[model samples]
Structure formats: structure tokens, C-alpha cells
Target: MESVRVPLGERSYDILIGSGTLKDIGRHLKGTAFWRDSSARTAIVSNPTVYKLYGDTVYESMAEAGFEPVKVIVPDGEEYKTLLWAEHILGKLLSAKLDRSSFIVALGGGVIGDMAGFAASTYMRGIRFVQAPTTLLAQVDSSVGGKTGVNHPLGKNMIGAFWQPSLVWIDTATLGTLPKKEFIAGMAEVIKYGIIRDSEFFEFIGKNKKDILNLNSKALTRIIKRSCEIKAEVVSKDERESGLRAILNCGHTVGHAIETVTGYTRYLHGEAVAIGMHMEAHFADMPQKEVARIKRLIESYGLSTGLPKDIDEGALMAAMEIDKKALRGELRFVLPETIGSVKVLPVKKDRVLKALKRGG
Candidate 1:
């Protein structure tokens, strides 16, 4: 087991990574300040699918540890990540008569974490929560950063809050049950950490691609720990994404557009990000050799590096305009300058259109 700390002063938390950590989640949450003084109550927010797999274990463990646990199951899918679902979770919280002292446990993937965290943040002007992310995408990225929210039709993660969590417990054992396509999608964010700031980690992934895909325990632990460290470091410096943190959205600008234009159902978040990185690199005129290398790496993980053939160029362009990174309605992309470095630059919409046409 390994732990990385997000040093946010009063809001600081630890991300615990290991193979069997889920079995200890009850004890871990009990150790928090929130659970120290009373019979701590927690609502385990999960999708029906995930709950079916690990619900009993989580509930039994919490009960044995003397904490009250409630199950709140939402439907599984990106389409359900909406205010409507968030309100549903809020209703559950209210029905339970959970007080401001109670915290929520987001026990599923990114969707559950985002919506549940958003609910906790807005409930009674903000409450505490813990993230027990079950998916790779959520484990390495969404669960650690404290950026929580549901999606908007205009863009992904459009309506959200910067509420930090009290703890982030990641059990690598959960990945063993992930579908192949979802696993491949997660590699996109892992690849982003390498492209944005860690060249050495990029090479490490290239060297161990086989072990990673094979689900070698050592390889999985190494990648998850390193990814969390990089994210924790970045978030500690820029907690609210005021400046340096924007770089973390390396592939997300075009990626979110792809998701919105495709109605958030066709491609997984990681898959859309893979294609986004490819198109944005092309638009930024990154080195051809590097671009090819990125595409090959992404393909090696069973992810696509190109836009959907039926994508609407007009809608794609329109989505980019509303991206959170845009400045004065201009498109701004996090362009890679080398293997380990990227810069944010604003480009013309027409130029982006030309790049999209070429990609098509």
C-alpha cells in the first residue's frame, strides 16, 4: 500500500492506493475527523451495477466498524450524469435525515463521484465526502482533484464545484472487473500525465505496455501511484484551476467537444480524450514524429486516436467556443511543446476548423 497527500492546508487529504484497500474502507473512513466523535453516518452513492458487485462488502465492513452506511444507487451511464440525477441523490440524503455532520461516500466511477460530490458540496452549504473510486479514470484523475460536477449540454463538467474531499481511497482490485473498453479509455488520462509533465513516466509506460495491459499488479500499482502523485502535486499548487491547473485539461478541450457533439453516449470519456489529444496536437502543429508516437501509444492501449467519422464539424466548432479554457470566445488549446511540456495557446476558429476538416 502507498499513500500520497494533497497538501491543501485545511482541506488536505490522502489518496491511499493498494490492491485490497476496499476491504478496509470502513476503518479508513472511521479514522477521519468527521467520524471520530460519534456514530458516523455515511451514504454510499453508487450505480446499480457497481452496488450489485461490492455493496455487501462495503456495507458489512462499515457496520462492523460501527459506522452507519446507507445505499443510494443511481443508474449507470454518462447520460444520467445530470441535475436531475443530482436532485435524486439530494432527495435520498434528505430522506435519510442526514445532518450536516454526515459525509457521503462516492462508491462508484467518475459519474457517481462527480454527482455525489456535487450534492455533498451544495447540501446545507457544503458537507464532507470521501471518494472510493472504482474505475481507473476516476481513481487516477476525477477522484483526486476535488473538481466535482455534472455535465451540461453545452460542455462536459460545465456545472461544477471545487469542493475537496476528506479522503480518496483507491483499490486497484476494482480495475480487475473493468470492461476492456473502459480500461482502455482510462489510459488516455494516464497518457496525459506523461505528455503534460512527466516524460520519464511516458517512457516507463511505453516500456511496460504489455505488463500494464496484462493487469500485472506491480505495473498497475506503479502507474496509479505515479499518476496520483502528479495530480496531487498539481492540485496542491492550484486548487481551484485558476492558472497552472488548466494544463491538466491537455486533451479535454477537443475531448469534451467530441463528447457533447456525439451526445455523450458514442465514445467513453477516455476514448474521446484520446481522439481529442490527436486532433489538438495536429491543430497546434506539434512535431509529426511525436504525434505519430502518441497515436501509436494510444492504439497500443486499444483506444482510437481519430474523430468519429460521422462527427458534425459545425457542432464540434461551436462546442469549443464555450470551453472553460476559451478566452474572450477564442479557442485555447493546451499544446505539447515536447514529450514532457505543454503550453496553453489561443488559436483562430477557422484554423481549428481547417484542422478538423483535415482530421475528417
Candidate 2:
């Protein structure tokens, strides 16, 4: 097992990574502050698909460690990621009689992590939560950054809070069960880390694409750990995203706009981000070769790098205008200056329109 630390002083936490860590969750949680209580309570938030596969394992593990665990299942889809679903999670949490002293265990993919963490953040004015992210996207990005929220009709993650997890326990074994499309979709965020922060990591991925596609254990462990490390380093410094953290939104600005315009169902998060990065890279001042390299990498993952032919340009612009990073109605884009470097700046509307057209 290997671990990475997100150093936030009093709120700092560790991300534990290893194969089969999920089975030992109880043993791990036993060392945390929450375990001090003899009658500790926790809600295991998951979706039906994930719960059916791993629910009993988590339940028995927590119970064995003396935690009173309750199952809280939500439907498994992006369309369900909303305030109403968040409310549904809250209602289940209340029914479970979870209190501020109680912590949440988000036990599925990105949607579950977001929903559970959002619920934990709002329940009784905030409580502790642990992330046991199953999917690759959740493991690499969503699970670690403490950016928890449900989507609004107008935008992705429109309503949420930056609620850090007490611990992020990632069991890589879960990836063995991920569907191929979602796995490929996850490569977008992993690729983003390389583009915006580490050129070497980006090269490493390109060279090892075959092994990564085959799910070689060593390759998987390396990429997953490195991805977590880069994210942890960034998040630890700018926990609230007031400054440097915005760079983490590399493809998210246009990526989210795609999601919002498509009603959150057409493309998986990473798929949309891949297309977004390909299109928005045009707004950057990077060399043409660098831009093509970015597009090629995204495409090599078997992901799309262009807009839908039927997409409405006007709606896409309106969606981008309302992105969380927008300033005074102008969208702030995190554009790559080169691989391993990026800038968060506002692109002009005409330029954005051009990029949209280019994407088409």
C-alpha cells in the first residue's frame, strides 16, 4: 500500500491507495478519530449497482470494527445528480439518525462521492465524511479535491461546497469492475493532470498506453498514485479554489458547458471534457504542434475531440457564460500555455464563438 497526504493543517487528511483496501476499510477507519466512540454511526452512501456488488463487504467490515453502518442507496446516473437527489440523501441520513458526530462513507463512483459528500457537508450544518471512490474518474479527481455538489439545470456542480474528507481511501480493485466506456472517459482527467501540471507524467501515459489499456497492476498503481499526488499538491495549497486551484479546471469550463447543454446525459463527464479540451485549446497561445498533441492524446484514449454536429451554438455559449469560473458574464478558461503549464484567463466571446465553431 502507498499513501499521499493532502496537508491542510487541521483539516489535512491522507489518501490511502492499494489493491483490496476496500475489504479492510474497517481496520483503517478504526484508527481515525471517529472510531473513538463506542457507538459510532456511519451511513454507507452508494448506488444500486455498486451496492449490489460491494455493499455487504463494506457493511460487514464497518460492523466488525464496531461502527453502526446503514445503507443509503441512490439511483446510478448523472441525471440524478441534483438538489432533489441531494435532499433525498439528506432525508435518508436523517432517517438513519446520523448526527454531527457521525461520518459518511461515500461508496461508489463520482456521483455517489459528490452526493454523499454534499450530504455530509449540509447535514446538521456539516459533519465528517470519508471517500471510498470506486470509479477511475472519482478515484483520480472528484474524490480527492473536496469539491462536492449536485448539478443544477443551468450548470454542472452549480450548487455545492468545498467539504474536505477526513480520509480518502481508494481501493484500486474496484476499477476491475468499471465499464470500458467509463474507464476511457476517466482518462480525460488523468490526462488533464499531465497537461496542466506534469509534462513527464503526460509522456509516461503516452508511452504506457498499451499497459494502461490492459489494466496492468503496476501501471494502474503508478498512474492512480501520481494522479492523486498531483491533485493533492494542488488542493492542499488552494483548498478553496480562490487562486491557483482554478487551474484544475483545465477542460472543466467548456467541459461543463457541454454537460449542461446536453442535459447531463449525452456524454460522460470525461468524454465531454476530452472534446472541450480539444476545442478550447484553440483559445490558448500554445504552438500548433502542442495543440495537436493534446487532441491526439485525447483521441487515442478512444474519446471524442469534437462537438456534436447537432449542438446549438447559442445554448453552448449561454452555458459557458454561466460557468462557475465566469467573471462578470465573461467565462474564465483554463488554457494550456504548453504541456505542464496553464493559465486561468477570460477569453473573449468572439474567440469562444470561434472555438465553438472549430469544435463543430
Q: Count of backbone clashes for each model?
A: 0, 0
lDDT of each: 0.87, 0.88
Tens-digit lDDT track of model 1 for 1-360: 799999999999999888877778887666766567643667889998899887788888887788888789899988789988999999998888778888888999999999999999998898889898999999899999898999877556789899998888888888889887888899999999998999899889889999999888889989999999999999999998898999899989999999878877888889999999888888776788988887887788888887766887899989888888988988999999887789999988888998898772
Off by over 4 Å in 1: 31-34, 152-156
TM-score of 2: 0.93
C-alpha TM-score for every candidate: 0.94, 0.93
Tens digit of lDDT per residue, candidate 2, span 4-53?
A: 99999988888988988788998778866655663477899999999988
Q: What ranges in model 2 sit over 4 Å off?
A: 32-34, 153-155
Model 1 backbone overlap count: 0
